[model samples]
Target: MSHFSIIIPSIRARLFDCRSSLFATFVLLSGLFAAGCSGSHDDEVGGTPPATVLQFRLQTLRPEIREIRESITGTGTIGAAQTSNIGVVTPGIVERVFVRVGDRVKKGQPLFQTRKNDYEISEQLARAELTAAEARAEQARLDYERAIDLLGKEFISQAQLDTAANSLKAAKAEAGVAEARLAQAAQRLADTTVRAPYDGVVTGRNADEGTYKSAQTFGADSSVLQLQEIKIVVAVVRVPEIYITRLSIGTPGDIFIGGMDGLFQAEIYAINDKVDMRSRTVEVRFGLANDDYRIKPGLFVQADIHPPERTAMLLEQDAILDRSGDPYVFLLEDGIAQARPVVLREYDPRKVEILSGLGEHESILVGPDLIRLTDGDLIPSIHDADR
Candidate 1:
């Protein structure tokens, strides 16, 4: 027996109420499916099984312009963006140690001490000399007055009287010189003690108590206490030299350091004008406000530097179809894979930015099989549900 009807076919007939009455459901779903798949009765004229039929639809997925935060990570050691090596300009034996390693010190805070015996002795000797000079000057002034009185009566030679006045002036000048030397000696005594130049941590110590120090630099490692300022920290990032025009001094950026999960605001403090010949990358330095002193110098860091201004269409990477050196995508125009060529501006593994060859409000295929498709391929998709 043969049975044929518009309402039922063999594929629909075998499905009964016991089997979830899927035939009724299939019939209903088929109405929505067939209207988009094919519109002719001759589509079912052949004894083709539903499973045997191949329905390849070219779906156009128009993804939005995804805002991308691009970055170039680098590994660099921490350093005091502005290291102030606390040391002494004068030489002396260290008499006392005021601060220890890891101590937070303020600007001008005394760091260490030196022997003051020499300066004190010099000051005492200068005071005694000044006193002696003053007494001698007073005596000479009295003698000159008596000589002038006698010379008025022509009792002594004029040359003798001139000599007495000269001696008095000499004594007074000597006393003034002695007083200046005393003040200078006191300042030298103060300079023997080292002090912090800025607020920072004490990281190094080159001298110990009773150790001799000199005015001249001992070596490149002449610093006594190596202090690092963590309060406005620096983050370095190496970006491709090609992006030189995109980044310059004062550019805004973001910092993401390990253990510091949240995004921290930063600004481009320095952009190296010279490009590295070997790596062809430019170094950019960022300044961050690390109030808690968490962003220490020499800690590894990363940065995300956004472009000042760039415009492009972003789409999924799967949407790109590379065919014989010609990369293109099939866009849906009235529901079809209309293969159109696109200029790939940026082809990231996750997404792509189109410079041109696409229009707004046009649906484009983002399926994996975009490479295997061609122009004018039929798309039995009334807004492909899978897309």
Candidate 2:
């Protein structure tokens, strides 16, 4: 029934038929049976096995050309448009404080007053001296005029006329000195009352009633109040030097202040010309309007500067791979994976702008299988994951 069974019976018959050459016949029959058995085994197993083919199911994407708006981000602090430390110009004991901390003030508004008795006495004395000097000058002028007339009429000696003229000149000089002293005294008296230099809100109050403020001393102890103008605010931010070239005055931006409800619209009002060598960053200032005095100084803030839009080749972030510090991607070429290094213009969590080493409509491998893939590995097919 089977080749091995049929072959064994034939071999036995051959061995018996040749008894004289029994040894030789048996040896030859045994070799023939082994060959037949080997052929049967090969037939049962379906001959030599076919070569193994490796297959893989992977996701791939093509780089796309699209319009993208680039945003440069930075963090900074909010500052008042203007700040001032209100202090006295003259030394005196503070008698009354008209405004307290957190009080809103207008231009020329009274903030505090110092003891004015000493300054008032000096001003009164200067005024009295000025009046007396003016009276003396007027009398000297009359006498000089009479002397001139008498000299012309030959009623007085020329020497006496010259003396009267010298007296008039001396009196005039004294009057001028007194006038200057009176003005100085008036200014000193006015300095006893401190007024707001501009419209602002009081942020600090260092002096209270009965506190002695000195002109010689400086800083908080000498200041009566600290005022800040919050009608407008400035955001001082440090931007990386790489992005500084893309920014200029009047460039629009959005600012996010900590604890604020919404983003504030702003613009690049100032940009520092010098870059910090140590940090390689440039200082930029954005202006924002705080008409209701809601924004305060020293608050933390974030800025998003919107640059002009441009067309670029963009790809999903997953398509790019980081080998050491350099970025790479696996490109599909003729059913094989090829590793390509790419230069990135910019990148976010979702996508990346390909500055070089990639072209639009080029197929690239993506997804988790990328880790297992190697350069020159055969890819049987590509799955368009982007679709």
Candidate 3:
């Protein structure tokens, strides 16, 4: 009975251990089978997905070719059309000053007169000497004629006649010298008075009545008076060298003076041949009529120079992109973004003049979101409205 019980228990324990092992194995296999079924169902529902393509609805614009007249602007100062420093040619004391500061005078008008006492005395002396020389010349001529008659009558020798003729020649030379001296003295006397060179207004007065002025001190700084013709004023401005080719004499423009109302219509009167190396600009002058003496010299002015009109391609400023100091734009071709370099002639706040590198029919992308785009980007659709 003991052996039977032991063998039966051993058999039952072995069977229980086998059943436990099989149940655990079945549970693991069932879990793996469920995972496989789930994976197969997923494969049947959806396979490998397609890559997403980026699409942008971008606005585009075509380059415009039209007649454009660009206005170049610069700031400068107003100057007199003609300026002169009035000074005395001869040295003397200022006896009388006919004009004062801010006095308007005409051409050939006397502005001042120097002391005439010394010059007058010299002139009188020169005239008296001329009279004496003429009398002596007449006497020598009479003597020569008398000597010639005596020689013909055998009363005087040929050598004596020759001596008389020589004396007459010397006397005539003395008279000529006296006449030149008189003329020179008269000129010196006239130079003592200063006259107006042209029609102008006296802007300054450096000398007063009874003030002694010297001829050697006649210059801009030592001028007795400063005269300027303000009936017509000149507006001087500097223009960039790039636009110099389009400018020429008689080009029309406008100028605005500081503290003055309205624009002054003017024309290009002059342009410098050489460009300034430091500023890369050229000096230009415009002439404007100032009939009422409203425009004064040394006043600040702004100039607007209109260049000649020409046919050119212009694009909106939004379309241009700068890459490493070079300007380029994204061109739309066959629904693809293509980058193309461009050469610019001028730049403005709203538009830019294109010199080259763009075709007439080519379209460019322009909008606020242009920075997000790159070269070779696929454009799925273009905006309906064309700019």
lDDT of 2 by residue, 1-387 (tens): 888998999999887878858778888999999999998998888867755445665778888898878888889899888889888888989998999888989999999999999999999999999999999999999999999999999999999999999999999999999999999999999999989998999999887899988898888767989999988889999889988768989888889999889899889989999999999989899988888888888999999999888788988887778833799999888888999999885466688888889878788998767888889888876687666
Which residue runs does candidate 2 get wrong by more than 4 Å? 1-66, 274-280, 311-346, 349-351, 354-387
TM-score-wise, the better of 1 and 3 is 3
Which residue pairs does candidate 1 place in steric collision? 60-364, 61-364, 78-297, 78-298
Please report, as a residue range, the 10-residue window in candidate 1 with the lowest summed lDDT.
49-58
Candidate 3, residues 1-387: lDDT per residue as tens digits?
A: 787987998999999999999999999999999999999999889986655657665789898889877788878899998999888888888899899888889999999999999999999999999999999999999999999999999999999999999999999999999999999999999988889988989998888888888889857877788999999988999988988888999888889999999999888989989899999999999988888888889999999888888788988887889833799999989978999999985556788888889998888998777888899888877773454
Q: Could you tell me which residue pairs clash in candidate 2?
A: none
Find the candidate with the highest TM-score and give its number.
3
TM-score of structure candidate 2? 0.69
Provide the global lDDT of candidate 1 against the true structure.
Answer: 0.73
Off by over 4 Å in 3: 1-60, 332-338, 345-349, 366-369, 372-387
How accurate locally, in lDDT, is each candidate? Answer: 0.73, 0.88, 0.89
lDDT of 1 by residue, 28-115 (tens): 8989888866745656776555543225634556756655556534444444667766566677777888988889888889988778
After superposing candidate 1, which stretches have Cα over 4 Å from the reference? Answer: 1-78, 136-169, 311-346, 350-387
Candidate 2 has its poorest 10 consecutive residues by lDDT at 48-57
TM-score order, best first, reads 3, 2, 1
